[model samples]
Target: MNEAWQQALSRVPELLAAHVQISVSALALAMLICLPLAIWAARSPRVAAVTLTIASLIQTIPGLALLALFYPLLLGVSALIGGGISAFGFLPALLALTLYALLPILRNAVTGLTGVDPAAQEAADGLGMTGSQKLYYVEAPLAAPTIMAGIRTAAVWTIGAATLSTTVGQPSLGDLIFAGLQTQNWTLVLAGCLFSAALAISVDLLLGLIERGIRERRRIWAWAGLAMIAAGLLVATLPLMIARDNIVVIGAKGFSEQYILARLIGSRLEEAGYAVRYRDGLGSAVVYQALSEGDVDVYVDYSGTIWTNQMQRSDNLPKAEMLEAIAQWSSHSHGVKMLGALGFENTYAFAVRPEDARAKSLRTLDDLARVSSDFNFGTDVEFLERPEWQMVRDAYPIRFKNARSFSPTFMYPALVSGEVDVISAFSSDGRIAANGLVVLADPKGAVPSYEAILLLAPARAGDQKFVAAINPLIDAITVDNMREANYMVDREGDKKTPRQAARWLNEKLRE
Candidate 1:
């Protein structure tokens, strides 16, 4: 391995540390939020049924959606409290993760607590033990194992779901998995996934040991196991939790695609022994604002998104000029430095089902415009509101009879189902090939060049070694590799993660 890989391995401790905080803090908060409800419900069949119904309802929503659900709630709260307390960052992550963590914990705690012998309860009452005293001395001690089992379930689930926190801009192993997948960097992704697995396994084992101790009351094993887990967490999180030091925060836009690029850069920076924080999943406007306000120090950003969405400039400059002008604007106006472009593009491409495009002669945006009033469109939530669409509409003079937005995850299937005749797909997305869709040409130059660039916080531009180490790696990624990497995940039966995909990218680049 090279120096960067060796160093990346070294910072596994830091990654683990950040991982534990999310898991533990969320678990702790979950216990406070859920345990009481569990106990109260445990006192009666009706209440228990009600409590279970609510907790189980939460479980039905997918982890990523559950996490996204909390953003609005926390955003409202943050608005009330106002001075940079963001729902889009760590708080929503923590809260949503905690909620996702609750069902197993509450369900198990209720089962264990109520499972205690009825005779034991009667005897405690006959002996005049108060309810609190019975709970403390008799019931709780015996129920500890069952409660701990719930905690174990919560622990594993918490870590797994915590990975999705990358969706909401919370950094954890998902950063590696998601970002690594985007660029097909498995080495980096493996580093993330293995550490995450190791953490979950290690935590599970430790909790298992504790549960056994509680069942057996073996004080030595209990104290020893708990102590080791605690000590390990303290050491692991020290660097990331220590935020006052001179650190650069790199951000990614909130999507699977952005997750890949951001994580690759963030993980590499941490490996180089520089401190880094990630602000991911921030809205298009919010990311630039954070960069301007100096909340986040650096991040991976798109050329087209910045041009059309952020700056409202709509010319298709040569790739070099576009990068130069954006970087110049960032530097001159906001003190941000666009380091250099990663050798990949994720521009908006209009696509149609292969059979339909073939049958209809719809090979380009110009073709679509002529028949725009007949075809329907499907796309992600943000794309519908973005200026690129307006520009495309104006330049190509296009319109469709019906248009709808769905999460990127659902768009391809919608097209396949004929629910939409056409959709705006990302150029780098694997779904293009996986689903047999045709990416129509932008023959009239409707869309701008959107090469991916690594933007640094103005102050971070000072580090030459930091800049040198990253530029080479970023410059190596290609659009085709990104498609294959994502296909490993989105394509059926692949089951590979972003990290696995990233490994392939890194290997190919080395070749």
Candidate 2:
């Protein structure tokens, strides 16, 4: 196997275990709540209507939006209750996924219970059986097959939706999928999809066996299927059970640079004798909050991001002054330590195809504004909503004919393909040079300096050995080296995995 496939396969066991853990937990919780509610709803039409309506409404929400909404909601709740909840990881993911699983199980179960034979229920009542006795003795048996069918549907749905939990900092098969999509690593993407699909199909088949057994009065099939599921769950739980001490958790945003930097950090920590875990594909805001909560031990973030997003500052400062102010504010406000800058500024650079720049005589923001009405603007997904974008608009009277968002991975391609005339490109992206694009100047300096910096959680800020191990990386990487490392993974041919890129970058640091 090639290095990419070998690396992708190596991660499957841990990712698959996490996938099974969360999916099964959500399914089990849904069943616990739904089965009892189904029984009660069967007896009362009003209860059935209200409960099923709520579940149906929940189902209408796109799984990704539902998962994103919980992070802020839980954070608000935590503040109101004096703060014990972790809004980032397993809890939010579990709650959202559990709700996603509810509709199918509740709907199917209610249908099954209410559709039970009236004659059998009546006969049980005639025998002096109570409501509970009738339900346990006659109604449940007849409804078993239908109820099992609902569980089967829910199992499949839950497993599929669980892949989205990676966005909220939860580890699942989605990690591979998200990272793969960012770096264009189809091997990783294929592996994640194949494993998740196989898991869902396998669970569906097992549940199908149980449903058949219940309907056909074949108990052995039901027992055998249930046994296999139990065995699988036991195996999934085993890795999670083996505890390790002083493990460091690293966080990364959903992009190739972030992925490479995270692996870079992890490699250093591992050399220092710390067990490392990564939470990749996190949003900008989610990652900072995670560090504040000490859920993440360390990560890289841009100086301007913390200044504008976290501090709510709009006025631009000199790079050195800005970094100092941010360092003080982070320490005072959130107990997070600003370790140091990484010697590169990955600022937002407005770029265009060389032909367009020369033909249109577009040399700067002012020049571009004159022709803005004819061009389409493309940007990374969050840039349109960021304060820097607003600042740029305020400083220059530029409005495009259209604006569209793409993932960081696709933004460059969209510009090159003429789908967009201009893009808010990253200054350190290797594609800017590889594609020979022209970067327009910002004479007014509307955008802030985005010096990449390392940040440590409060707990790790004072660890002498940990600090010593990572301190050399401070101001060690140049923008040229960073871009080269990024291109190693982002290039269409001879692509290296993030780990390989990180190792190469580490060697560069040493040289």
Candidate 3:
């Protein structure tokens, strides 16, 4: 077998663990939520119409957005009740997936409960059985098949949807996919996707067997469900119950810029007496949720990213205005706080190798667009989908006939090798100059600012010692300083160990 397959096989244990939690939790919760509602809906026409309609409507939402939507929503409710609600990671994914899991379960519950034979109901009633007793003893048994089928469907849906949970900072099979995708290793993505699918299929089949056995009056299915779920819960809770201490988890998006910032954060936190852990190479959508959920305590973020991606604000507000708006939004919406800026913006820049640019005379984006049809494009995953790309494309009308994408890792190499002539490089990336790449001028300001800033989880905001201890490092970081930091990992192959990078940065700052 190839090395990719070997790595994929190695992830079986992790994939299995994550799959069990996401599927079981979402299914169990979906059953709990839907069963009662389904029964109630079964009792009346309006109830069935409304509740089922709502559940179905929820199911229609694409998984990722549903997960994203619940982070802030549930966090808001938790905040109103108490001070310790973390909206990120497991909670949001769980809640959204639970909702998604409902349609199958609710529909099944309603069908099962109400589908009982009228003759049986009449006979039970004639025998002087009470409503609860008759329903429990008679209807529940008969409905078991339908109910289990619903659960089977719910389990399948949950397993499939769980892949998206990673976006909310919840770890699962998607970790493999994203990690691999960010590094341009298709083996990783295939491993994650295939494993997750296998998990879902296995679960669906197992549940189907149980449903059949229950329907067929075989006692083994009952024993199996108990065994499977019990085993799953034990495994799922084991990781959490592991001893944790004054551990601070820092996160970063998959790129050079995020690497430097995460390193800086980890370093500062350690110096101030925290045992730091790293959850580096997170996706943009996932990183914020991870922070809100308390999966990650802190990380470096951009004001414009918070403003646009998280808050859905489109205003080209000035730097101060944008930062203030994002800060307020985070506090009220996510129970998170923003530390001030790191004093430099790391915006997107389209660059080509100096040789390639010279040969093509592609100094400006407009000049490059004429030859765009001959070139391929490489950019961060988020940029490929953003409106900024559309705006830039419209302004310049650059039609790269052979457009392609690579993870930030491979982009530099591709550009240098003429595999892709134009790459969406970050301003703070050290690789641009290292590879003698020239950044094209975006005469039209389509892309927004991505100023580096420190974001604090609400739990940490009250600790003045914590805030004051690290606040000084932000302004101390300059563009050149950041570039050098990125170079250590990207070019120097410094293992991308942010903690080490951060300490080196701390010493530099101290000096």
Candidate that would win on TM-score: 2
Query: Per-residue lDDT tens digits of candidate 2, residues 1-511?
Result: 8888898888888888889999999999999999999999998999999999999999999999999999999999999999999999898999999999999899988899989888887899899999888888988899999999999999999999999999999899999999999999999999999999999999999999989989999999999999988998788667777796788999999989999999999999899999999899998989999999999999999999998999999999999999999999999998999999999999999999999999999999998899999999999888898999999999999999999999877899999999999999999998999999999999998999999999999999999989988888998999999999999999999998899999999988832
Q: Rank the candidates by lDDT, best first.
A: 2, 1, 3
Per-prediction backbone clash count: 13, 0, 2
Q: Candidate 3 local accuracy as lDDT?
A: 0.76
Which should have the higher lDDT, number 1 or number 3?
1
**lDDT scores for all predictions?**
0.78, 0.93, 0.76
Scanning candidate 2 in windows of ten residues, the lowest lDDT window is 236-245
- In candidate 3 the C-alpha lDDT for residue 376 amounts to 82
Error of 3 at 244 (Å): 2.2
Task: Indicate the worst ten consecutive residues by lDDT in candidate 3.
Answer: 492-501
In model 1, which regions exceed 4 Å deviation? 1-11, 44-46, 241-244, 254-286, 289-293, 300-364, 368-387, 390-511
Tens-digit per-residue lDDT, 49-83, candidate 3: 99989988987888888987886687678879985
lDDT of 1 at 328: 87
User: lDDT of model 2 at residue 401?
Assistant: 99
Stretches of candidate 2 above 4 Å error?
none
How does candidate 2 fare on TM-score? 0.98
